[model samples]
Target chain A: MKYNYLNGKLTIYLEEELDMNSCKIIRGVIDGYIMKFQPYELVLDLSDVKFMDSSGIGLILGRYNLIRLLDSKMKVINASKNIKRMIELSNINLECVQYE
Target chain B: MNENYIKIESKSRSENIASIRVGITSFLSTINIHFDELMDIKTALSEAVSNAIDHGYGQEDTESIVTVEAWIRDEEKIIIKVIDYGKGIEDIALATTPAYTSKPENEHAGMGFTIMESFMDEVIIDSKINEGTIITLTKTIKKRKSNSKKVE
Candidate 1:
């Protein structure tokens, strides 16, 4: 997975299954970017993500914490139905962001 | 039908996570469960295994084994167990509490037990301070009735 900083927003493109296997890398990358670039907002694009487990949830929540610390916003886009349901069950708004 | 088991042992490396996810999903799908139910099972199982690898094993290079067992009972209940022999949780009660994690530096949300409790019908954890841990979860499937009176 790779993340890019553009237009004052940090966009992360996820690949492969977002389970424990990829969390370490994903977390490291996102945190590094957040600290270095300090973007005004964070956007996680999950168009290519095929699977996500509870660890994935933890990863997102951790990012949410960081974004809050920076007084910024975070949004997810193109999440799969399963991922969408998981997010919704966690009481996050799905319509605020686009779903592909 | 009967007891079906899959075991994978590796160092505390994160690479083994994919295998664990695949193993649990395959076992659950073979029994003809709903997708939502399967996702719940998978999520809970992944949390358990990740805890074993990340917390119990400390994400070290030492050998750690994560064993998963699944079985169907009378075609009604599905049971799954995840076992690991590593640095057993010192405080089972506190460990399972939400936002309580031994390793917070790894960005641990400490919601593993919370997710497990929400996903599974029943969750039991057995652990010893220096011994190991075993987490068992069971869920009963609701049968769909196809013989309901037809609407005229």
Candidate 2:
């Protein structure tokens, strides 16, 4: 995971598989960035992600809730067709997060 | 064609998830299933194996073994079983319910079984408390009227 912060907007590029193991590693790093930057907006870039199971949903929803608690906004961008399909099947009300 | 079987046994480690999925995917690739169909199966298989590693063995017990066995029968039906010898699921109905994770602190959405159920044609779970859990997933490949693999 790589993140860039500019003008109160932070974008993180996610890559590879997002399963239980990778999610654990990612959550820690992202949370660290969130705490340090405290950016008003958080954007998750998923263009490089090749595989994601339900754990990816947890990662997104968890970050959504986390950012919301900090009075920040979060959006998921560039999700692959298959990744979007997995999120749709979950049906978790992620209204706060945007997908593009 | 006769039935083809492949079994993968590995320790319950989170790192092994990728290789296990790749192994199963490679095994199934000998057939003519569509790309999306293969993706669905791979996702379902990942959920089953993740459940075994995360919930079944508690992620800390890497010494235990998780077994994955897949077989293709009748050239169209594929059946896979993910087995783990860790703490079994106490309630089958509740576990399968969407958004029910035992580890809420870990941001677990608890959609493992649900994902498996939706992607695969049928997901049959057999578990015993303090024993283990065996998840059997089955899907029949769609017969294409044309040579193109795209479903739409």
Candidate 3:
């Protein structure tokens, strides 16, 4: 639910369930950080996220698109097995980050 | 009355979605189902709830209610039902099309039905315009092999 920027990277720390309700806030925060920092890389830290739905997938894909536009790299870290499976099922690269 | 059936009713808002996943997981676990199968069920449940909130409830008010029911029949079939009373879909066929979203501005890919279909054994949708939508999903657990088969 909270996002921060540091060391040329935008780190989004998510808590609770990441679904349709939270996706709007997530998108807004990510967009604001991307525009303000213009970081060369965007890192999503999901250690605190207990659950994620397809809307969560949409959030990731939307950020991926934004990163592509800015010529930056995007990675997700600390995804649970459930989250990882959802990401993989969506055809996104599973090796893009080190799972914790 | 089956002892394995589980029911959860919460606001159609996104915050209550975890209840759906928890409900499915508990039902699956009681039957000794594996984690992978549970994840598949969780994914399908997530999609159904998302559709209920985003499409059914229009994702505007968090006060709307969404109901989810899960149960296992004869220790073989898992049935999950997600119901929402919202604007409802006038065209069920058009609404379920992959990559077709009513709210494209939110970057919705409209793959909820597709994901549900891919994960569950069968999907049934019942809805009436301006009334509500009910999504029923059924999945059968595959028997586990006792022999260990290692893959390279």
Candidate 4:
């Protein structure tokens, strides 16, 4: 995972499978950045993610809540077809997610 | 009646999820299964394994073992069972509910069983208070036309 903070926007690049283990690691890293930068806009880039399950959804939702707590907005970009379907199956209102 | 089976036993650690996914998917790839179907199975399997490691062991007892068994029968049916000998679930019905996470503070959305059911054709859950929990996931693959007689 890689992240960049520019102006008030923070973009994170996630790679590989977002399973339980990777989510744990990624969550901590993202949370740290959120606390430090506290950006006005947070973006999650899933272009490099090869596999994702419900755990991935949980990760995104958790981050979304965290971003909201800081009065910031979050957006998910470049999610693959399977990842998008998984998100849809959850039936949760993640209006910020944009599929690729 | 093409058949293949594999059983894996590993510690209930988070890191073992990747290897388990690869092992099960590689075994299924012996035959002709669509990529989407393969991904669906993989996602369901990952959820089961995550439940075993996270909820079953309560994220503290990594020494406990989680066993994953997979079998492909008749070249079109696949069955996977994830077993964990840890603190078993008390209420199966409530646990399977969408977005009902026992650990809300820990960011657990509690969609493990829900995702498994959505991705697989059948999902069976059996748990005892102190014994263990077994999650059986079954899916029927529409065998595509391929020269992979290896399944036979």
TM-score of chain B of each: 0.84, 0.93, 0.88, 0.92
Q: What is the C-alpha lDDT profile of model 1 across B64-117, one tens digit per residue?
A: 677777777765587888788877888888988876777777766677887788
Best by lDDT: 4
Candidate 1, which segments miss by more than 4 Å at Cα?
Answer: A2-5, A35-37, A84-100, B1-11, B143-152
lDDT of 4 by residue, B1-152 (tens): 87889999999888999999999999989988988899999999999999999889977778999999999999899999999988899999999999899988667777888889888999999999889999999999974656656855
Task: In candidate 4, list every pair of residues with a backbone clash.
Answer: none
Residues B20-139, candidate 2, lDDT per residue (tens digit)? 999999999888888888999999999999999989998889889999999999778999999998889988888888998888987888889888988999999999988999999999
Superposing all C-alpha atoms, what RMSD in Å does each candidate have to the true structure? 4.5, 2.6, 4.3, 3.5
For each candidate, give its TM-score against the true structure.
Answer: 0.81, 0.94, 0.80, 0.94
What's the lDDT for candidate 4?
0.91
Per-residue error for B139 in candidate 2, Å, reads: 0.4
**Model 1: fraction of the reference interface contacts it also forms:** 0.54
Give the alpha carbon lDDT tens digit for every residue of A1-100 in model 4. Answer: 7889999999999999998888888899999999999899999999999999888998999999889999999999999999988888888899999988
Instruction: Compare candidates 1 and 3 on lDDT and give the better one.
Output: 3
For model 4, what is the error of residue B104's alpha carbon versus the real structure, in angstroms, after optimal superposition? 1.4
Q: A5-95 in candidate 1: lDDT tens per residue?
A: 8888989898878887788778888898899989898898989987787667678888887888999898878888877666655554334
Question: Against the correct fold, how does model 2 do in TM-score?
Answer: 0.94
> Once superposed on the true structure, which residue ranges of model 4 sit more than 4 Å away at CA?
B143-152
